[model samples]
Target: MAIMDLSSLNNLNLDAGSIFLLAITICAFLIPVVVILPPVGLQKGDALLQTHTKAGVEGARSNLKNQFSAEEHAPADGKPPRVHSLVVYPVKSCRGIELARSRVLPSGLQFDRLFMFAQLKSPFPVAVDSTDAEKSQHKWEFVTQRQFSRLANVTVDLWLPDEMKLRKQSMRSDEAFLILRFPWKEDGWRGLFATIAAKLGRGRAAEPEIEVLLPVDFPSAAEIKEKGYTFENVKIWKETINALNMENELPDELRRYLGVSNKLALFRVDPEQLREVYRCAPSEEEAGYQPVTGFQDAYPLHLMNLSSVQKFSSEVPKDDDLKELDVLRFRPNIILSGAPAYDEETWKQIRLKPGSSSLYNDVSFHVSCRTVRCKMPNVDQESGLRHPREPDKSLRAQRAVDEGAPLMGCLGMQLTPLFDPSLGEDRAAWIAVGMTIDVEERGNHVYIKQ
Candidate 1:
């Protein structure tokens, strides 16, 4: 029995050794393939895709403090008023309207960027085949900068089908078309119209052109009444102000008016301060932080001031012909009128009442990050026009791109609560005022007094 057991053990050992050798040989052959092959065909992460950090926020604030201390202390005599303007972009790249009252929501302003036009086909460089048809077929997806930059130019007029009859006009063919104009360059018009035509097919040619319309009719009281429209048109009226005219560009009165642009709806925060409280940069974390609650984008919030717009206008090329300083280029929810130039860097907190609510329910929002300007800022919001030439002739004008440190506007404050009951229960949550702000600047890391 002992000898039989030993023989079985030897046979088992031989079999185990052969199996182990085979496994090693297979692994040796497969290891190099695993190392060389890309994972799921994804490219290497981009270096430009940086992770914003508290350290970066501290550096930004330090530079801002040193450069603008005097301007910050300069008497408030000529400073803009403390009014606020609350603007909402119902459709993503189309025009946004100033709200008399709005609700605060977690994602952003209620009904903000809720509707968008998806191109059924590429509006540019027409595609030759339907093999990649998915690229061209656009659904009415949510609005974002990714779809259109001049989305603020696309205005809409809501109607009950019957009211729309008046604006509908018949052209050459028995077919009537909607007379729609975008505020930005008409570059995409041909493509957009063609796409629309294709979508309608030959069957609807006799019918009036049904364009995607925003609820806003016109900006002026007279225009709104004359048009017999029911949607908000405050932005249209404000743009008609002489201050926004092409020649005058930025107006002095607008500086004063900026404060009341949306006093109850907007807030500004110091990014460094925000990082200290969350223990992480804004984009790196989820949306529970005060800043994320108000400003839905990756950055803290959208910010713009009359002073900064004016500053950009002053640097327009001397030899070039430029249009008015279009504020709509930067789609900011809250437009600040009174803050000092570049003062957003140091701002800590702001207080505002929610729209449609009694004054008793006023809310507070905290400032989180500094808004960085982009090339889109150069587009003319009124005409839907863009610079015709190259980098030298572009609308960026004199704006300089600062890598580590950039100038920003204290547009408005972000809040903790995502929704405000005043706007509506179904509306998205909003960031409000009265929230505390944490600053993370180099030596002065601390919370700002509300």
Candidate 2:
């Protein structure tokens, strides 16, 4: 029987070497597919799942979660909470207006930060005589800290028409105000602060007058007020102007804006205090883990609790003359009103507009992470405006504890909107927060199923 079986095997013409070669060939193709394909599918699946999960979670968390267990479902203070205050900056970096209602686009707020000034130097005779050249040069010049710290103090009224006009307030002489034609003829058009100085032969001069730019066709506040484009408050303008002024002293490579973001779009409010929970481990130490390269920039949304602001205000000294809490220092995108004490950090999700209307036509924003506070908040927004002897200790104390540290009380959310390139400068963006996601906290840096 054994001899017969051996004879049958030999007749089949299959050897151990042949079998092994076939197995190796099969693995070469299949192993890579097995290793690489699932991850791609997992990433796509995770993103989609996260978006839906966040949306559902936002509604539930806000309604169910509260700092005081007894107040979970009850409305705090008998008033509905405000989820976000949309702000738009018409110029790139100047200032912003808090809008009760705003038009949204894929980039962010519509008609926000669309125009910018480019600086150029020229001396053609015809160029010098043309009105266009004069207007172009005026658009380019800006004031910086290097020339005068008070350059930020200067404010201008921007009037848009066939010709743009910049009316500057008098600095040395209160009654002697100056009006300069933006885009001065001698200097090239498109440049912001630089063009203004170059045209007036004050390119080398320290502390030249500040200039403003307006769209040639857009109506003024009076004309647009009836059309629902009325001008509201503009207190945050100085903060951005100060940031730009400080950047001028730094190198060009370090400069984020070359007076381009004159129309400031957003301002935030960050928690003054935070506690560190844990530091992330290296990627190689864990199985199936990849380190996040931009971990430093991890925050997805910034949330400000209205109650927390009130709590801080209660601690102010009786002798101190503190005004409203300045929102510009923190630079948050969304400001939440009527939240329970320290409840923002516990929020897993936040919906911008619930059932009434979509955040932007057919889009919505999801809250994802906790916004961490930075050292920039320490700078007093009203330092130059207030008296020198005034005790500005609250901001200083807040900064001492918050510099380069994470704040625990605030929450952030990741906004996932369908990409639409035609939406122009209305791209949806995220804000900073300090907390780590559970998936990120565990060995799996890659997003995983909750």
What lDDT score goes with residue 96 in model 2? 35
For candidate 2, what is the total of clashing residue pairs?
57
* Candidate 2 lDDT, 69-154, residue by residue in tens: 32332235555455534443333323333444444433334333432222222324445457875645422232222222222233
Q: What is the lDDT, from 0 to 100, of the residue 70 in candidate 1?
A: 35
Residue 435, candidate 2: alpha-carbon lDDT? 16
Candidate 1, 443: how far from true, in Å?
Answer: 9.8
How close is each model in CA RMSD to the real structure? 28.7, 30.1
Instruction: For candidate 1, write residues 308-397 as lDDT tens digits.
Output: 555545555533545445455567766555455555545444455433333435444445544434345545555444554322233333
The backbone clash count of each candidate, in order, is 64, 57
Runs off by more than 4 Å, candidate 2: 1-80, 90-93, 111-210, 214-303, 316-323, 354-363, 378-450
Lowest summed lDDT across 10 adjacent residues in model 1 is found at 237-246
TM-score of each: 0.41, 0.35
Give the least accurate 10-residue stretch of model 2, judged by summed lDDT: 267-276
